[model samples]
Target: MFKSILAAFDGSEGSEAALSKAAELAILCGAELTVLTMYRHHSVLEGSMYVTNADQPDDVDAIMSNHAKATAERGAALARQAGCEKIRAFVKGGPTARTIVGFAKEHDNDLIVMGSRGLGSIEGYLLGSVSHKVTSLAQCPVLLV
Candidate 1:
């Protein structure tokens, strides 16, 4: 029985499945459900490289952070619809896998739930999937959907 459950969500199909499962588990266990969405921080150099119009210069990191916040809200809404009463959502900017593991540990979550795959970039293929890294790094149990 988990006291607190952490669900890593990114507004993807796989994350939706994971969120549903996490919500179900949280309801059954009477645990607080926390939905987290992560966005990688963009360096100034990288931000500069993005195609931006002279009229409206886009801040890449701000855009990503906003999107992440929205995604977390969506996940929390989905969990509420699935009957999870104690639900919270958060958005973070960092390395995804490490940040998820760190957040779970910091919050003392008993279990971590996430999609087997997510909206990963080319670096994921070159390095490894976030789920795989989180499974390796997490101190608590991880459930991949």
Candidate 2:
């Protein structure tokens, strides 16, 4: 039985599936459920950085972080709805695969679940196929949804 379970979400349908699955597992095992969302802080427009990734005037990073955090919160809610007793929401800033793997390892999670894919390359580093990399690099067992 998984004692500590981590679920990664990015507001996608696949991520929703992963969250639901994790919730079910948590309920079954009476395991702790944690939801993780990784965010990035875009650099300035100049100095080898793409204009699209530049820091926007309207706090786009904040909005994205909020969205991701909300996704995690919703996952926690689902865990509660599924009768999970220990539920948590986590949001971190950095590369997705690294942040997620690090979080899982640091928290000693027995299971890691995430969506199969994400937004796109232009949007973020972990937007596409990041789940595959996390599965390859993570120390614990990873279930790609």
Candidate 3:
């Protein structure tokens, strides 16, 4: 039984499956759901420009931050539609796997539900999926949806 669940999403097709599964599990367990997304914290272009002018605005970072916020809003809407009353969302930067793992840890999540790549066995092994990395490293139980 899960009291708190964490679902990692990127507004991508793959994450759609994960969101649905997390919602189902949350509903069955009567658990609160938290959706998580990761975005790069800094803009490569702006960072590079800092060498010449450190006072200029960071256009790239602002652009990416807006995108991340939009993704979180969309995710929250989807979670609400899934009949989850205690749905929330958080955004972080850095590696996807690390972000998910850290968010789960920080939030005291009881379970993590993520999407499987559904690739062929060979492909899965050759190109590891984010779900695989997260499940393997997370401290709590993980459910692949």
Candidate 4:
């Protein structure tokens, strides 16, 4: 039985499935569920390359981080609605697969549940999916939903 479960959520359809599965497993195993939402840091170089709205917030990175935190909170709420009693939500900024695996290892999560594909960019096709990288990198068991 898993004592701590980690779920990588990004508010996508696949992630929604993973969240539901994680909640079910958490309830069954009586484990504490941790929902993680990771977003890439918006670099100043990227922002400079793209035109910004005059009324847009100047702190773009903070805005993106806040959005990720909100997404994690929503995922945690869904888990609670799905009957998971012990739940926590976290948000981070980094590469998705590395962030998920690193958080799982640092937190000593027994199992990782995540989507097969997330809201990835074109690099996913050139490189690989986040789930694939996570399965290869993670020390614990990983379930892709």
lDDT of all predictions: 0.93, 0.79, 0.77, 0.90
The local lDDT score (0 to 100) that residue 51 gets in candidate 1 is 88
TM-score of each: 0.92, 0.81, 0.79, 0.91
lDDT, residue 26, candidate 1: 99
* Best model number under lDDT: 1
TM-score ranking, best first: 1, 4, 2, 3
Deviation of model 1 at 139, angstroms: 0.5
TM-score of 2: 0.81
How far residue 22's Cα lies from its native spot in candidate 4, in Å, is 0.2
lDDT of 1 by residue, 65-126 (tens): 88899899999999999999999999999989999999999999999999888888666564
Ordered by lDDT, highest first, the candidates read 1, 4, 2, 3
Native-vs-model 3 lDDT?
0.77
Residue ranges of candidate 4 with Cα displaced over 4 Å: 50-56, 122-128
What's each prediction's clash count? 0, 0, 0, 0
Where does candidate 2 clash, by residue pair?
Answer: none
Residues 26-130, model 4: lDDT tens digits: 999999999999988867877666655677666677777878988999999999999999999999999888989999999999999998877886666643389
Error of 3 at 133 (Å): 1.6
Best by TM-score: 1
lDDT of 2 at 66: 75
Q: Any idea what lDDT model 1 has?
A: 0.93
Give the alpha carbon lDDT tens digit for every residue of 37-100 in model 3.
7776665765665443355445656655667778877887898888877898887777777778
